[model samples]
Target chain A: MLNTHGLDVSAAIKTLVLILDLVGTFVFALSGALAGAKHRLDFFGIMVLSFAAGNFGGITRDLLIGAVPPAAITDWRYLAVSILAGVLTFFWHPAIERLRSAVLVFDAAGLALFAVAGTQKALAFGLNPAMAALLGMLTGIGGGMMRDVLLTEIPAVLRAEIYALAALAGATVVVIGQLLLLPSAIMAIIGAVLCFAIRMLAIRRSWNLPAPPD
Target chain B: MLNTHGLDVSAAIKTLVLILDLVGTFVFALSGALAGAKHRLDFFGIMVLSFAAGNFGGITRDLLIGAVPPAAITDWRYLAVSILAGVLTFFWHPAIERLRSAVLVFDAAGLALFAVAGTQKALAFGLNPAMAALLGMLTGIGGGMMRDVLLTEIPAVLRAEIYALAALAGATVVVIGQLLLLPSAIMAIIGAVLCFAIRMLAIRRSWNLPAPPD
Candidate 1:
C-alpha cells in the first residue's frame, strides 16, 4: 500500500485516481473555456477561467484541509491538462459544442471522481466523517461554482437538477465505507459509480432539489 | 512585538487589525445580505450569501497561503459578525437599502482593510512581494466577486471604476513598505489610507481602467 498521508492506497489505485482526476480536470476546463468563448472573453480571461474551473475545487478543498500549495498549483501535470483543455476548446469550440451530450456525461464522471477524491483527502486529514463528506461535495462542485460565477450564471450546483446532492451522496458513501472498514479501493469505485449514476439519472429524469417556499 | 507566526506585531497593532477585519467582515456581510434581499432569496440563501460575502475573500487568501482551516471558519468572532450583519439586513433591508451611498463608503473601507491585511499575511508567509500584493488584491475583491456571481451579476471589481487597480496600489504599498523595513503598524495604516483615498477618488471622478478595443 502506498501510504499517502497514511491512507492505505495501492499503487494501482493511485494510478486510477490520478487518471480520473486528470480526465475530470480536462472536462471541466473544457466547460469553462467554452463558456469564456461564448462570452467573447479575451485569451487571458479564457485561460484564467479554464484553470479556475478545472482546479479551483481541489484547491478549495486542500486549503480548507490544510494541504499547503495545492497539487493543482504545484503539480505541472495538472496545469498542463487544464491548459491543453483550454487551448483545444479555444481553437475548436464549434466542433466541441456539437458534442453537448458528451460534455454532460464527462461532467458527471468528473463530479464523481472529485467527490471521492475529496472524501479520501478529508479522511486522510482526520476531519469528522460528516465534514469530510461535505468537503467532498464541495470538491466536486467548487470549480463549477467558480466558473459559473465568473460567467455571471447561477451556479449549477445551486440550480441544476440534483447536482450537489449527487456529490454529497457519493461523499457519504466514502465516509460510511471508511467507518465500516471497507477496502479503500472498492469503496472508492462504488462511490464514484453511485455518484455518476445519480447524476445521470437526474439529468435524464429532470429531478431537482425543492426550492424553499416563499 | 507580539509574535504571531513569527511576525513581530505589537498588541495594539494586533487589536487594530482585528477591529478593522471585523468591521470589514460586517460591512461586506451587510452588502451581501442586501443583495440577497433585493433578489428575494429565502432566509437560508440570504444567510449563506452574507457569510460568503463576509468571509470568502479571507478564506481564499488564507487557503492560497496554506493557512489551514481559514480563520473565517475557525474564528467564532468572524462568524458572529457575519451572522449579525446578515440578520440585521434581512430584517431591516428597506432602511439599509436607503443608505446606498453610506454602504459604498463602508465597502471602500472594507476593501482597504482587507487589501493591507491580506498583503501582510502573505508576506509573513514568505511569499514573493509581487505575489503577496496580488493576494492582497484578491482578498479585497474576492468576497464581492463571490456575492455578485451568486446573484448573477457582473462582478463589480471587473466593471467598477479603478476598483481592483486601487486594491493593487494598496497592496503594492504594503509590499514596498515591508521591503523597506518599515514598522508593520505604520505600514498597514498607510496602505489602507492610500487604498481608501484612491477608491473614493475613483468613485467621485468616475475613473476606470481602460477597456480593450471592441
Candidate 2:
C-alpha cells in the first residue's frame, strides 16, 4: 500500500511536469514565431522556427539522457502547441509585438520551468549532480540558441547578459535539494521561482556580464 | 564455426566504421579550424569551433538514436583528433589556406564517409529506410551547419551548392543496398564513391539548387 502511494505521487509529479513542459513549449514557440516575423520569414519558415525553438531544448535533453524518439517528436501536444503559437503570431504579430514585455516575462517562466525539469530528468537518468545542473542550464538556453542560430546570429546566451547563469543557479538549487532529500515537487517549484525572479531582475536592471575589451 | 565467422565479420565492419568516423572527424575539424581562422577568432575560439564542427553531427546522431554519453564525449580519440586539427590550423593556416582545393576534396570525403556510416548505424538501430537516409544526410551536414551558425552565417548547404542532396543520395544508396542484402563493406564503398563523385562534379560545374524569386 505504501509502495502504491509512492507510485501515485510519482505519477502526479510526472503529470505536473508534462503540463509545465507544454506551457514552456508554447511560450518558447511564441518567441520563435516573433523572431521569424522580425526576420521577415515566410509562413513555412515561421512554423519551422516555432517548432525548433519550442522543442529543441527538451529534445536535446531527452536525447542526451538516452531517451529515444524524444517526446517532442512523439507527442502530438507539443506539435499542436508549437503550431498554435506560430499561427497566432503569423496573424496577430502586431498585437503580440505590442506585448513584448509580457512575452519576455513568459519566456523567463519557460526558461525557469525547463531548467528545473531538465535537472530533475537528468538526475533521474543517473547523471552526476554537476552534469545535471549543466544539462538544466542547456535546456533553458538551448531553444533560444537554436532560434538565434537559424536567424544567422550569435546565440544570445553567449553574448547577452546573466541568462544562462540564472538558469544554472536555479538548476544548482534543484541539485542541492535532491542532495538534501527534499520533496522534489517543492524543490522544482522553488527552483523555478528563483530562476524567474533572477531573470526578471536582470531584465529590469539591464544587467549584463562583462565583455572583453575591444 | 559459421556463426563465429559472422561475428568476426561484424567486428571487422565495426572497426572499419570507427576508423572512417575518426577520419571524418579530423577532416571536418580541419574545415572548422580554417573557418575560425578566416573569421580571425582567437586560439580558444578556433579550438571550440573545430570541436563543434568535428563532433556535433555524430553527437546529434548518437543522441537521437539513444547512444548516451556520445562517442565524442566519452572517447578520448575524438578529442585528440579534434585538438590536433585545431592546433595544426592555428599554426599552419596560411599553408592550409593555400591548399584550399585539397581541403575541399578531403571535406567531400568526410561528407561521404559520414553519410554512409550514419545510414548504416541508423539501420542497425532499426530506423525505417527513409528516416535513416535523412538522419545520414543530417550527420553529413550537421557539423557544417553548426559551424556556420556559430559564425552567424547561413549554412552553405542551404544557400550555396549541392551539399546535403549528395549526402542524401549516398545515404539512399546505402539503404537500397541494405534492402538488397549486399555486402556492407562493398555497399559503403560504392555509396561513398557515388557521393564523392557527385560532390566533385557539382563543385566543378557549380551546380546549385534553385532559389526563390526576389
Candidate 3:
C-alpha cells in the first residue's frame, strides 16, 4: 500500500507498485532499444525509440483524460528515467544479446503492470466500465503501437495473444469489485495479479482469440 | 468558418480552411518522407513517418478534448492523405528539392490553419479560454514535434519561430471574438491569417526566444 493522493496503504505494497512501474518503463525502453539496434539505428534514433516506448502510452492516456500537459511533461523525473534507461541500454546491449528472450520477458511483465495501472486510473477518472476497459487496453498497448509506428513496422499488439484482452479483464474485475463492495486493497491486488496471470497463461499456452470469420 | 455543432457560419470560408489544411498536410508529409529517405528507411517506415508528421498533433488535440479514438483512428481519409502524400514525395522529391523554402511557407500556413481550427473546436467543447489556447498551440505543433522525436531529433518547437505562439494568438482571438459578439467568419479569417503572418514574420526575421542562461 503506497500513499497515493493521501490513501493509506502498506508501504511495502505501495513501493512494490512503484517499482513495477519503473521496471515496466525500463523493460519497455530496453525492448525499444533492442529493436533499434536490430535496425542499426543511430544513437539518436535509439534514444527516441526508447523514450517513445517508455512514455507514449502514459502520455496518450493522460492527454485523453484531459490531464493536460501530462505527467510526462510536468514531471522531469520521469523524463530523466526514460533518458537514463535509453543511455543504459545503449551501453549494455551487447551483453544482452546472449539472452535473446530476456527483453521479451521484461516487456511481458511491463505489459501486465501497465495494464493494471492504466485500467485503475481510467476507472478512477469516472469513465464507464466498458470504456475504462477499452482505455486500459489502449494504455497497455499504445506504447508498443507508437514504437512500431515510429520504427515503420506494424505494431505487435495487432497480432499478439490476449495482451490487451488481459488488461480488459483486470479492468472489468475492478469495476465488478467496486460494485460488490470488495476492499480497495484486495481489489487492486486481485486485479493486478489477474492481469499478470492471464498474460502468463496466454504466453505459456500460446492462447489467442480465434480469428473472426474472414 | 464552417458550421460546427450548433454554430452556423459562412460556407465559402470553410472551403478555404479545408484547402489550407490539405496543403499543410502535403508539406508536413513531405518533411517526414524526406527524413525517411535520408535514413534509407523502408516503405513502411516512410509511410509511418508521413503519418506521424501529418496526424500526431490533431490526434493529440482530439484525444485530450475527450474525442475518444480520435479522428486519426476512426477516419480512413486521414490515413489516405498521408499515404498519398508520401507516395508523391517518394516519386517526385527531386523536383520539389528546388522549392524547399516554398514548402516551409506551406507548412507555416498549415500551422496557422490548424491552430485556429483547434482553438475553435476546443471552445465548442466548452473548455476554458486559456486551455483552449493551449490546445490550439499543441495542435499546431504537436505533429511536427512528434515527427522530429520519431526521427530522433530535438523538436522544432524548442528551436525557433512563432509556431506555437502564433497558434496561441489565433486561439486568443477566437476567445475574444466570442466575447465581443464578432462574426465567426471574420474571427476565423482574421485569426488564421494572423497566425500565418506572425509565423511568416518570425521566419523572415529569424525571430527567436532567448534560451535560458545555462
Candidate 4:
C-alpha cells in the first residue's frame, strides 16, 4: 500500500499536479495559436490569444478562490510555456494543422487534467463540494471558451458539445472521492482518466447535447 | 470642508459607491438584453445574457482583488437589478429600441461608473496605480465584451472606438486623486464625468482607432 499520508507523498502529488497543469496550458495554448493563425492575426495577436487560452482558466479559477495574483501571473513557467506554444504554432502551423487529430487528443487530456486539478484546488480552498465541482468544470472549459470568444465564435461548450459534461463528471468523481476520504492523488488519476475517456468517446461517436431546433 | 476622515463620511461614500454600482449593473443588463433581442434569442437566453453582462465585470473585479464570493454573487441587489432590466427589455424591446440614443447614453454612464468604481476598489485592495487603472478599463469593457462574445461577435473594445481608452482615462483620474490624497467620492465623481464626456463625444464625432488596411 502506498503511504498516501506521508509528507513526501503530498509534496510529490503537488509537483505532479503542477506538471499536469503546465501540460494542459501548453496544449490549450497551441489551440489558441492555431485559432489565431486561422484568423490571420498578426504574430503579436497570436501570442496574445495563446496566452489567453493557456492561462485564462487557471487565472479565473485562482481569482474565484481568492488566490491573489493568480498562478498564471505569478509563475514564470506558465508564461514560458504559452510563449513556446505560440512561437511553435506561428512558425510551423501547416505541420500542426496536419496533426489535427493529435491536437484533439491533447485537448481532451488537458480538459481532464484541468478539471481534476481545479476540483482539488477548490476543495483545498474550503469550497463546498458542489461549488468545487462546478469550478472544476469551469476551469476545464474556461480556456477554450475564452479562445472562442476572442475569435468571435459561440462557445462550443454552450452550443453542441459534450465537453463540460465530461469535465463535470470528472470533477464529481473527485468530490465524491474526497467525501469518501480516498487518497487524493489516486482519485485525481481516476477522475482524469474518466474525463479523458468520456471526451474521447464522445468525439469518436459524434455525441452532442441537444440544441434548439433550427 | 467635509471631514473626509470621519467614519460617517466613509460610510456615506460606501453607500454612494453601492448605488452607482447598481446603476451600472442595471444599464449594462439593459444593453445585454437589447443585444439578445436583436439576435432574436429567446427569453431565457436574453435573461442569461442580461445577468452575465450586468454582473461579470463586478464579479471579475472582486475576484481579481481577492474578494471571495464576489459582490454580484453574494448580494441579491445585483440579481434583482439585472432581472428588472431583463424583464423590462424582454417585454418592451420595441419601445426600448426606439430609445436607441438613450440606451447609448446609459451605456456611457455605466462605463464611467464601472471604471471609477473598479479603480477605487483596486486601489483599496493595495494594487499599484498602473494595475488599478488597467483593471478599471477591464471592468468597464468586460461585460460588453462577454455579451458580444456570447453572440459570436468581435468585441467592440478590441476592434474599434475609444471605449477602453476612455475608461482608462477615467481610472487614471481616480488613481491620481488617490495619490494626491484627495477625497475618493469627489475623485470618483470627476472620473465618471470625464469618462461619460469622452464616450459621448466620441460617439458624436464618430471617432475610431486606426484599423488594419483591408
Each candidate's DockQ score against the native complex? 0.19, 0.16, 0.07, 0.16
DockQ measured for candidate 1: 0.19
**Root mean square deviation (Cα) for candidate 2:** 7.0
* Candidate 2: segments with Cα more than 4 A from true spot: A1-51, A64-66, A72-145, A154-214, B1-15, B179-183
True contacts kept of each: 0.30, 0.25, 0.05, 0.25
- Clash counts for the predictions, in order: 0, 0, 4, 0
* Model 4 C-alpha lDDT per residue in residues A24-143, reported as the tens digit of each score: 999999999999999999999999999999889888888887776888999999999999999999999999999999999999999999999999988898777877887798898888
The CAPRI category of model 3 is incorrect
Better of 3 and 4 by DockQ: 4
lDDT of each: 0.86, 0.86, 0.74, 0.86
Kindly give the stretch of ten consecutive residues in candidate 2 chain A with the minimal lDDT sum: A1-10
Give one digit per residue, the lDDT tens place, for model 2 in A21-80: 899999999998888778766565576578889988888888888778676755668878
Q: Best by DockQ, which number?
A: 1
Q: Where does candidate 3 stray beyond 4 Å?
A: A1-15, A100-102, B1-95, B99-214
What's the TM-score of candidate 2 when only chain A is evaluated? Answer: 0.92
Q: Model 1 - which docking category?
A: incorrect
Predicted candidate 1 versus true structure: per-residue lDDT over A1-214, tens digit per residue: 7465876667666787899999999998998999999999988888888999999999988879888788899999888998898898888999999998999999999999999999999899877787788789889888988998888776756544788778889999999999999988788889999999999998999986543333
The residue-by-residue lDDT of candidate 3 on B1-214, one tens digit each, is 4366655455665666776776777677778887777777888888898989888888888776777677777868778888987887777777666678998888888888888888887777666666676677778888887887787765656444556777778878877887788986689779888988888998899876533121
Clash pairs of candidate 2?
Answer: none
**Candidate 1: Cα lDDT at A18:** 90
C-alpha root-mean-square deviation, each candidate = 7.4, 7.0, 10.1, 7.0
Q: Score chain A of each prediction against the true chain A by TM-score and list the results.
A: 0.94, 0.92, 0.86, 0.93
- TM-score of model 1 vs. true structure: 0.62
